[model samples]
Target: MDDSVRALRAQYGGTLPGPVEALPAPHRRDLAAVLDQARSRQQRELQESTDASLAALPKPLRALIRKALGL
Candidate 1:
């Protein structure tokens, strides 16, 4: 693991918040796919919110939100 990740583990008293590796590989892949879908949905929602505020926000702030959402 990278130093930063190791340091983070140590920061949390050398234990993970959850049993990260307890799940089998197939279950892990399914979990990753679900997380990806949720993240995509979140990005879409953020974009819709920014779109609804197009005229209310300054051009810079709207652009910043779009960039932050990776949209």
Candidate 2:
């Protein structure tokens, strides 16, 4: 694997699901960009999901939890 792929696998606990190294240089760059975007979207979705779930709680309790968690 290339250093980039190895680094990604290490950072993400080996869950990255494709062979990024075998592509041509331009395609590799495009794929890397796509992967970066996917990671960003996944993070945003997770944060939104957490916020939505927390919103289901009582307001006062949610406020307290948020304060305690420094959210």
Residue 37, model 1, lDDT: 78
**Model 1, range 1-71, lDDT digits (tens) per residue?**
44433443544456644564455556555655675677779999987876887758787787787677776
- Residue 2 local lDDT, model 2: 62
Error of 2 at 45 (Å): 0.6
> What local distance difference test score does each model get?
0.62, 0.73
> What would the per-residue lDDT of candidate 2 be over residues 7-70, giving only the tens digit for each residue?
5555567656556555555665556667778988999998999899899999889988888878
Worst 10 residues of 2 by lDDT: 1-10
The alpha-carbon RMSD values of the candidates against the true structure, listed in the order shown, are: 7.6, 3.9
Give the poorly placed runs of model 2, Cα more than 4 Å off: 1-19
Predicted model with the maximum TM-score: 2
Top lDDT prediction, candidate number: 2
For model 1, the run of ten residues with the poorest summed lDDT: 2-11
Model 1: residue 70 alpha-carbon error in angstroms:
12
TM-score of 1: 0.52
